[model samples]
Target: MYQTDNLKQKIKLFMIIFFPILITQVSLNLMTFFDTVMSGRAGAEDLAGVAIGSSLWVPVFTGINGILLAITPIIAQLLGAQEDKSIKQKVQQAMYLSVGLAIAILLLGLILLNPILNTMDLEYEVRHIAKFYLITLGVGIIPLFIFNTLRCFMDALGQTRMSMIIILIALPINLLFNYIFIFGKFGVPAFGGIGAGIATALTYWVISLLAIAILYKVAPFRDYQLFSSWVRPRVKEWLEQLKIGVPIGFAIFFETSIFAAVTLLMSAYSTNTIAAHQAAMNFSSLLYMIPLSVGMALTITVGFEVGAKRMQDAKVYGYIGISGGIFIALFNGIVLFAFNDYVAGLYNTDPDVIALTVQFIGFAIVYQLADAFGAPIQGALRGYKDVNMTLVIALVSYWVIGLPTGWILANYTSLEPFGYWVGIITGLSCGALALLARLIHIQKKYRNQIENSSAT
Candidate 1:
């Protein structure tokens, strides 16, 4: 009874943190959805332009964010150790890093823009519009990174509601801007999809500035004095963040790129196939937010406990997070599976797209549990600062094993798109199992270290 009660309490705590983060994530995604929808109304060419631009930007942006994600656990650990004095310095260095990296990314994007577009063989109009969109959006990258840096800092300290509220405020603002700019409302020139990019860029600046103000002026955060003084960037601290962050960045890149690759590969099939795949992927991605949020909360909790030198408690929290994630996954899987047709219909009215989407959803259902397991385990690893192995596992599981199997099944066999999804299932399962094993091994290793220290 005690164990059960403890698990319930832990789960409750996890949810308390998870839901707000989940809402923030959903709001961010909704911003993108609004951009896409509004751009689509402009024209097919405009839509394709935004889509192509997004494909280029999303991976790079996601990679940068992943790298910065290291700060979350680092901050959590600092707070856990009650080393509040050190927090400002670390955040300052992170701010410097974020700005520097953002500028570099922008320059790189500019340098690579023409070359990358040339290789895509896109229609001239599409290519031209995409170039404009990229350039416009590129201007916002710095603010985006800055916002993310402060957001991570706050979330690590368990101040999620503020960030969530800020993001919520931005969503409607983003839509209003998108409408005005995309349609040239109130005398604004119709920049079409490029206008959407402009609106998003402007939104980034707004949100980042708001976040900065909140961190500096908000009552809960005022005592931290996060911006009290700028610290010169130290090589050792930057290296430390890179050591933990680069692998995480690559891990995220690998996962997102694989899905992108699959979508590109599916282009070889019928338009209906592509549409169906996208519909299924969209819904599945939304469902994924649940576990992702829980996983992030677990990272903070476990990192805090570990920093406090409470390894057993960390382990307990890790298990509770994993268990909670699995339960959520089970529930999502059943709902998605049972309502596949009905849900797919929500995205499209075409009978063919609907049928194909339902079929794809079936595969998503099978792997939902694996996804749930893998994501939280990864989070737990991050909390323990055990991140390098995750990159290796992801590489082997997704590329070496999963992608090849998928390619062969997709190309050599009649399974086609279904085969690719099967590969996803295999990869996710392998990743989940591998991550679980690593978590167990690390827990035992930490326990032994503590035991030895005590005995000595």
Candidate 2:
């Protein structure tokens, strides 16, 4: 019932789109690493403070990203089906919902940061630094919805390279702000950890604004006018998006919680160990961008196919995405594993910290490959609008297996920090295996049904 194209072109398209995204993400991640490294040099407490606060902030920000993702695939499908009439209306509705959700998350972050730091039971300096970091981070996050709304529309129209360009502008600005604000270089006051917070807050606003300008200037969004109609969201459409988005949000939270919990636990180790762990994690974050960007590309392609009711085409796109991820992951893994010592040293200079970071980096490389396989599968599921089942797998993987496994191994066994990383491995393996099986099963069933109908 559905027409399909060759996998080679699909792979090519995925890569072509992914390259820019990968570069943007890697650049942005390096900016973050630079910020953390700057603070780490000021003092371990300064570094620890930013690390603790960032863990809390990122999940909240990511939750909004997850919610916005719900609208993107639907927009993709709508594009493929040539449903131009409803496109503006659907995007407007999703934007309205996203703004509300982003505000809510930002507010929650603002209100909870103090309560959270109060409970961290750290030294007063650490707690003070974390609290300041969170408050400023929250201040600038309010405009995040604006960025996502434009980006989502661009994504639906197959214009993701613009995201790279926008971030390219923001990356240098962030580094500049961090340099001036953190160490007070160039005659600025040394804000230290507080300066990192200030720089981060400013970076978000710059990226959000810069991204919009880039979208309007360069992209082919002449069809979808972002300012044309500021109508109230249709109640019916809002309900539909929420029904699709909320479960995915929960799944994002489930995964974020495991990583956050582990990062917090690592604080129980020596300050240097925590620093080492953060460096490795920061680098891993960069590696993660490859799979994430690939997954996103596949989602767009697959969603386009699915909306056209070309199920086979969708499956092929998924295959292309996963293959792309495997190749990228293997290449990056080999490089990271080979240069674990150098890679860890890039974040901090202490010998013990570097050694610990090397250990974590080795584990992260292996886990990233597993994560690479899983990330695209999640994106594919999103493409098919298959959030509910994926949510179950995420819940079981992170909450059921990941959290408890890490705690038991890290606290009770001799593995300690390495034990905690095994949890990341378990979660990735479960997510990848479970989602892969589900994707195949669904494709097989749908294909059979189509065949049966044709026979009739």
Candidate 3:
């Protein structure tokens, strides 16, 4: 009875943490959904422009977010070990890293913006709009990174509800701004697709400022004293973080870049293809929030267990998380497969766009099933600080195997978008299987260590 009750308590705790994080993720993905839908209404060309611009920028944003993700487990473990004083310094270091990375991304975006667009073989108008969108969005990358850093910090402390509230508030604001700018409402001239970029930039700034204010004024966060003193960048700390974060960043880049590559390749086909791809991708992202949320929660949970020197508990939590994620993926996959046409219609009314979107959705369902296992297992590894291998696996699966196969199938066969999606499935499946195997190995090793210590 005690054991059953304990298991129930753990499940309840996981739900409490998981739901808010899931909602927060959903809100973030909704921003992209809004952008795509609004742009689609403008025209096919506008939709394609947003799609291309999103492909270019999402990788940059996600890569930086992945790098900053190092902060979460660091803080989680610190909190778990009751090492409260150490958190302030680490938080400060993360802030410095965030600002530096934001600036670097901004500069890189400026340098490569035009040249990258020119090489894409896009239509003149599409290219022009895409360039405008990319530049406008680029202006906000700094604040976006800062916001992400704050979010990660709070998440580590198990304060996801506040973060979810802030993001939920931002959603309506994003929509209002997108409406006013994209359609030129309330006396503003229509910026069309580029207007979505402007809205996104403004939203990032608002969210960043709000997050900072919350960290400063919130009663719970006051305990961390994150803002008590400003510290100069420490070479040792920064290098240590980078040592952990760079592999994470590269792992994210590998997965995201494959999709970006697919988007670029699809650009050569037709505007309809791009628009269809955008719809399918956006919906897939929305569904992805499920496993991703669970995975994120697993990171904090497992990190806490590890910090408490409860290796067996950490392993148990990892198993629960991975299993829950796969189950959710199966449920979502069924829904998507059954209702794909309805979902596609929600994005665009054009028959051609809808038809292509349905086909792409089929691929997305398979990809999600693989991703269900991949994402959470990766998160479990992060908690164990077992990341470098995951990076190597991602590189080999996505770039070495996935992309080349996709290229050949997409270019040489009649598969077109289907071929690219097949590649996504292959890569995600490979990643999932590899990570799961690693997790089993690590669990065995840790169990042996525990047994030896007990014997001693």
Candidate 4:
């Protein structure tokens, strides 16, 4: 009866924590879906253009944005410690840090843009169009980064629901611009992929502005002097946060690069196969947002508990969040398995493309469940500031095993697209296995330490 009651209470707490995150993550992914559909309407090349650029850019920016996540643990710890003074400074410092990270990525973007596209060996029209899109989309990086910083700052304070409202506004605004610029529906001339880039850039600024406005109105800490800090930044605070954040950034880079590399390999197959992979990938990405959000909540919860010295409760919270993630992922996996045809059909109009998409969707459905198998463990590791292992795991997962296996199948054998998805499954499964082992090892060690300390 005690166990039963405990399980029921966890379900209630999980629902409260999970729903808002699910809504926000889903909203943000919806924008990406809308962008893909708009690009699809333009042509195969246009679809390929955004895919190529985003394969590189999305992970790059998202990884950089992870830097600002320092605020969550910082704020959670301070809030637990009841240090209202440090909380304000920490938030201000995080903004500065986020902006710095964004600017650095912008420079990297400029240098990396052409070389990355050039190496792809695309045709003249395709390269030219893709370059234009990459450069224009690169312009949006600063706002996107800054917005992510602000969003994380809010999320740390438990006001993450703000992001959902902002994206709700940004969605129609992005679609309207896409309609106008992609087709020249309004007086604007048709620019296809380039127009899509501009629409995306404009929406970035709009969302950032809306985020600022909402925060100023609602966040009680608006009085904090970000630009004119009462004192020079405590360098120690900045360094501590970066120490925690940079490894996380690289961890994300290594994991996401697996997808980028696979997509590059997928180019070996016919264009239809790539399109099919895209449909399934895009669909899987939407589902991934759920687990990702749960991961965030788990990380924050664990961090908060650590800050408060509630070690046992943190352990319980980790189990609850991860278990909730597994349950939700299983349900999502089932739905994707059941509805692959219908979901793939929504984006893919080509009969051949639709057929290929079904197979890719089969892989996607399984990946959704595997996501639970991996991401939550990574999140728990993050809560403990143990990220260096992920870097090594990434080396093995993406570069050593995944890439080579994929190449052998795509180039050296007949498995083709099926081989590509199989390689991803293999890499994720191995990575998940490693992460689970590490998580158990560390948590048990920590529990022993806690027990000894209390006994003393």
Candidate 5:
């Protein structure tokens, strides 16, 4: 939104947008971190159950949320292009699409939950907890979807701080709920890991209601009159958004589901192995929030510049964002490398679990730079609406190349669980290279188009 081309101003704007998003994302992931830590204290079985449930929930939820994420770039571009009149309707249509998707996912998840768990070679307790956890977690799907829709809307308008504040408010409430539920306080039966799911479901509803209240009562957002008029859901608009959204959705799904797949593969190992993997992954995910936030901010900044027909400015933003992300990742990797053992001990007291977790975090450290590199570039591509190729790249990189290599290495070699991490590192590095190339191509094409138009 800062119109000045000054480098200092650009960096300031990027930071202004990036920091709130960083907090928001960190807060969101912390909820999961709390769930893992609290459930782990309850029992190893509890921790593994929650981890498996999360593996199922994450891919499905993020994939669908990725579709709704299209709203950010769409609205950002609309704002940049000064197409304000169309914003309200697009938002309404997205809301409708979200509700419909939530209901379908909930119902389908219910039908498939038992079948999926049955297939996993899990302990009886682990399987039981995983099944019920997902079932309880399903209660929040609609609200979560709605909350994300509102969050994306707010974010596109450079109002990242609003969502940050709302989630900050939700964080303690979520922690409290987790404590009360997981510990069985106040006459509630101790449901262990399932309590975490209940707490999360309740927290989702809390955040959704808070977001709606903020939007209605807050200035500027209220001026949009988003809720003022009824816009009937039209198939045409749904398809239009989906055209942009589906690729983004599946691209995220493919990438995230690899982690989920690894979690699933770990199920056949000892309960300790599963627990260790989950803890390391949970910590790794917390670290990942940094680069991920950078990418989300890039989508907004780059989308706005591209929409304003300033391809060069968009390129500058991409460079700033990507470089900043990698630098932070290097710092994170160093810290994580130095303190991984201490970090691992935060999850559980069992020495074996801690040791395994520390080893896994080492692999996480190795991948940080590559992960930082790819994530924000994907955000930049979304800004250009160049998402379809990203989907293909993600599929090929993670599934075709990464997962297969991991499977062979884990099953056929001595590396065992650590082999999967090697594969993940390899995949992330490859994806980063491919994404960088694609971003370069898109930038050049647009620059040429602009030059020709100016010459004529």
Candidate 6:
């Protein structure tokens, strides 16, 4: 394992892992950013449709993808323990699980998606765009799931720069496709917001193919023979991973679904309201990538430390990650506060849209610090494999506390859409505090166990 005793050494190793992951994360999110921007340019209806479609898609994607995410820490810990023999088999099993989950999600979408959209009071264009956007996006689901499994494997191995490079290659292709489809370049029909879906779906395939090639061709990766040495699907291994994955999946789902729920709620309001909300949200999500990357980095770093029985080193990584996340959020807040209008304008030029987006960004500013605080700790806890509490915390803090507060405030008072933002801020703050306390308890418990063992 890398040196963890020296603060500088730890920080150096952290950065080595962090920077590529940061670029990879931010670049991936930029796909959404481009989608929103390009769709917004197409028209308000286009933007709203894509936004609504995304609201539905994101939670499902992340929740299921979160299951695949377990491979990262699982492999990281295995690496730390120098247990390399089972690595290839574990990844193969994860691939099988990813395929199964993708099939399940697809079936669910077919059964439930249209009904859910139908229940929402959306504009005709918005509804049409949203429906087709999801359908088009669906074509890529299997590949995307496969790709993410590969990504988690690579990330766990700390081959993040390779992931970063693959995504960077995909980004421009996504952009080009989005333009061609959205604007009807060459022979393609104008798809508007649905084109963004087509673009994203195609991008998923591209990245997945690229990732596979890398695994096949790369030195250390090829040594694992990820493709040739496929392991048969075993229920026992699947259950073991699902044990780790399901809570992580649900915790991510709960948090993401809160935002989706809020967006769905906003459907009752004007299309302009939904557009403005989405614009602010897209920009905020872009900024969120910073702390989020920190959190992701922590998962690998701290997981390795904990797996190596270095409790203090794990704690140090957690502290550094959490502190750095909050500090970066503060810096993001300053940027948002100073240039809220400019950022809002990037999404749309409609005066009302820009104005409301600016207002929502204000709410975002208030919560940046809290979001930063919570996210990294969540990552840290995952490193410790204390995910059940993370799931409970997310459920209560987001659904029980946050969503309800937003609903009441939006309906019972004049806050409306802004009220939802307030609720998000409240939930994030609560989750942060709860997670911090949980991390402390887990750390102490592990430390005591280790100490007692040493004494004996």
Better of 2 and 4 by TM-score: 2
The residue ranges of model 2 lying beyond 4 angstroms of the native Cα positions read 1-4, 215-219, 449-456
lDDT of each: 0.83, 0.79, 0.87, 0.73, 0.93, 0.92
Residue 271 shift from truth in candidate 3, angstroms: 0.8
Best by lDDT: 5
TM-score, one value per model: 0.92, 0.94, 0.97, 0.92, 0.99, 0.99
In terms of lDDT, the poorest run of 10 residues in model 1 is 1-10
By summed lDDT, the worst window of 10 consecutive residues in model 6 runs over 1-10
Candidate 4 local lDDT, 125-243, one digit each (tens): 55666788767776777788778777776665656667777887888898898888877886898887777787888889999898878766664536544434445556777888888
User: Per-residue lDDT tens digits of candidate 1, residues 1-456?
Assistant: 012126567666667777889999878877666676577567656766666676677778877888899999999998888888888899889988899899999889879989988877566877777899989988789999999999989889888888899998998899989999999999999999899899899999989999989988987787888887777889898888989999988887777666766765665666567657766776677788778888888888889888888888889989888887889899989989889999777655668778998999999898777888888888889999998899999888888878888899998898988999999888888988998999999999999998999999
lDDT of 5 by residue, 1-456 (tens): 546477788889989999999999999999999999999999999999999999999999889989999999999999999998999999999999999999999889878988899999999999999988898899999999999999999999988999999999999999999999998998998999999999999999999999999888898899888888879989999998899999999999999999999999998799999999999989888988999999999999999998899898899999998998889889889988999989888889999999999988888898777888899999999999999999999999999989998999999999999899888888989999999999999999999999999999
lDDT by residue (1-456, candidate 6, tens digit) is 364669999998899888999999899999999999999999999999999999999999889977998998999899888899989999999999999999998899999988998999998999999999999999999999999999999988877888899999999999999999998999999999999999999999999999999999997799999898567899999998999899999999999999999999999899999999999888888888898889889999999988888999999999999889878988999999999989999999999999999999999998777888898998999888889999999999999999999989998889977999999999999999999999999999999999999999
TM-score of 6: 0.99
* lDDT by residue (tens digit), candidate 2, 348-450: 6778888889888878987888888888888888888888898899899987887788888988899998898998888878888998999898788767877
Q: Cα-based RMSD of the predictions, in order?
A: 3.0, 2.3, 2.1, 3.0, 0.8, 0.9
Model 4 scores a TM of 0.92
Assess candidate 6 and give its lDDT: 0.92
Q: Which residue ranges in model 6 land beyond 4 Å of their true spot?
A: none
Of the candidates numbered 5 and 6, which has the greater lDDT value?
5
Shift of residue 103 alpha carbon in model 2, Å: 1.9
Query: What RMSD value applies to candidate 3?
Result: 2.1
Candidate 6 displacement at residue 38 in angstroms: 0.3
Mark the 10 consecutive residues where model 5 has the least summed lDDT. 1-10
- Write down the lDDT that model 5 would get: 0.93
